[model samples]
Target: MNYNSPHKGMTLIVKTITRITVGLILLYGIYITLHGHVSPGGGFAGGVIIALSFIHLMLAFGKEEALRRLPKPLVSLFESLGAILFFTIAILGFVGGYFFLDWLNKGEPFKLFSAGSILLSNIAIAIKVSFGLFGIFLVLVLLKFTPKK
Candidate 1:
């Protein structure tokens, strides 16, 4: 297994195209995640897109390459961390005497950096969903179903 070239799974054209578009896809996911509070899409949708980008890497290059980019241990770490972060954020609302309360100062409306903890909450959810979906995909890909003769 040549760790240098993860593009061995698909044809040259697919690999090239994936290499070019994967970044854009991931970036778009981030954009959707960030703009979720005001836009139609939210954290779950963005996270799925983000996970799709990684799956696209696996389809274009190979599982080894995708795993190289997102290892099992890291996935596990992020899974727990994201959950904890989200829980912590919700818990922080206790200062305002409520669960999942909006205590932070919400800036001007329609601005990129506005909405306070909403954006942070969206981010945490995105991280958790992305890692969870990606991990599920990896498991399915790794599953070896025996053929019945």
Candidate 2:
């Protein structure tokens, strides 16, 4: 209910630096998510990091501002779209005369853009999980404050 706190009005310099840092973290999370299949990170890890960035913003700016920036419906739509895209790519392999095909370009590992299908799937999962969690958080926060008739 009361998402705002007395500590919300923090110093401007700290807030500015934090906002920049969060932006960087979110970008890094996206990079990790997209490159997961070819590297150390993966969907879950990157998704959590992405969610954490938003959570930090929520803590800094309050739930109302965060919700305004990222509405629940948009998050849900993105989550659903990501899942659909991932599934569609997976199913394409079956229709392409192969079952469980990797669909990768078979380039050298550790390259900038290698491990095609796995990379794509990882991206999809990252988007789905991140937005899904955000949506859940929005629901829980709203429900906590929603007035019962």
Candidate 3:
């Protein structure tokens, strides 16, 4: 629960560099998530990048600081919301009388915001994965720092 860890020894410059790297990674994650439907990147890849951002922050600073940036409750809410959104989208296809059908408008290919259903799915997945990984990471960090009984 302590933000100031006694184990930290990295110089200010190193910490600054690390923070910059983490910020870049987070931006990349958002890019991947947004462009998932049009390119090779997707929810999973974007989610991993998002999680890596937090991981990098945790490594550079500490668990407490990372948690401050991304609280457990918020992450958990996002995870649940993402799951619900994904399921709702999937259900829409079924309600439309097609199994796993792509309901959203599939616009021109190679466009930034084309492929509506695919984009929606990718976004849902990204949110789910990012929050899920963050939750897991938070738990692991807590366990690692907990004092032995």
Candidate 4:
């Protein structure tokens, strides 16, 4: 059977499997990020997982397909936005007379919305880490494969 698609990479089985599992991977990453405070995994861990999903796609479907899903410009944009979001939230903490302070009301312990600023921070960190890691992976991959002058 012809495994080749418009974009080139692994075989049909690999692609099929990747297609089935990538979304689950992404969702798991998100779950980790959201419940970070209540659980062990946090933004950094979740972000790595998220980035891995995209990397998996690249490995299974090739660079063209991966780039099509997350274009370079969008990656750059997300990276910037994540940083901006993190910075903005940090700055907002000044309202409480400190940097990175938990200005928002701390709800009941162990609840989803219990940690206000922390949740936001985790989200920002996740966004930054996910796109940042993906960007780094892209750079390393492209750099290594590029022809020497």
Candidate 5:
């Protein structure tokens, strides 16, 4: 847990477990996001999963390594871009004379390719949620926790 030390964060056993689980966690996040339209899990939930995976990395390896993988600036950019993309899609629905309308072709039901706007919206939301949460975590991590003198 000493950030300055060569052996920074957790024990080797925890680090090894994290390395094994991280990819699975990320993949599960993607799966949840993609299946949002049909299932109960949606953009926000999936995004939380995704963010947790990164946060797990930070917890196991330390902030330095996690930040190296995903810099704050890049995460900020992704968050903003997600918002812009979400808004753009909403605005584009105006073309159909409705807000958040399904202007795009709606493919067959229950299939992966179905639910036109929902899919895109889920993606946008996932991006926003993941990066936004991660950014908050980073900000918290950077705070110097000094006890009262």
Candidate 6:
């Protein structure tokens, strides 16, 4: 059998398990990010989870597949977009005469939308973190790691 196939990576068992679990992992990450305001997990945690899912894919299915799903350019674009979004949100606070102010209406407490601008900030942070981490991972993987000559 040809071992150099782009689809080739880990063994069949690992591939099967990864295929099954990756979606669930991604969903769980989204859940943690969206419900962070009400729960303990927040943007950073959720973003790490999300990046791990992609990293898991890369490990199990090889970099080709993972990069195909989330190309490097798209990753950079998203990271920049996240920063822009966070900055824009902060700038909007200028209307309240301060930076990073909670300018939006705070909904009923303990509810999903209760955090107002915080929720948006969390989303922005998640976007930035997830993509930034994944991008860094890609760079490291591409780097030639050589031991002493």
Instruction: Give stretches of model 1 more than 4 Å off.
Output: 1-7
Q: The CA-based lDDT of model 6 is what?
A: 0.89
TM, every model: 0.92, 0.82, 0.84, 0.90, 0.93, 0.90
- lDDT per residue for candidate 4 within 36-103, as digits (tens), equals 99989999999999999999999998887788779988998999999999999999989999888887
Candidate 2 lDDT, 23-142, residue by residue in tens: 998998998898787678998789878988887787677677788889888888999998998888788788557865776576778786787688788888888888888777778767
**Which candidate model has the greater TM-score, 2 or 4?**
4
Compared with the true structure, all predictions reach lDDT values of 0.89, 0.78, 0.82, 0.89, 0.91, 0.89
lDDT of 4 at 51: 94
Model 1 residue 34 distance off true place after TM-score fit, in angstroms: 0.3
Local accuracy of candidate 1 as per-residue lDDT tens digits, 1-149? 46346436887788889978999999999999999988888889999999999999998888878888889889888978889989999999999999999889999999888898989989999999999999898989989999999
TM-score result, candidate 3: 0.84
lDDT for residue 28 in candidate 6, whole number 0-100: 93
Residue pairs that clash (backbone atoms under 3 angstroms), model 5 = none
lDDT of 3 by residue, 14-124 (tens): 677886698899999999999887778999899989988878787778666777778889989999999999998888898668866886777888898788688888889
**Candidate number with greatest lDDT:** 5
In model 2, pairs of residues that clash are none
Model 3 has an lDDT value of 0.82
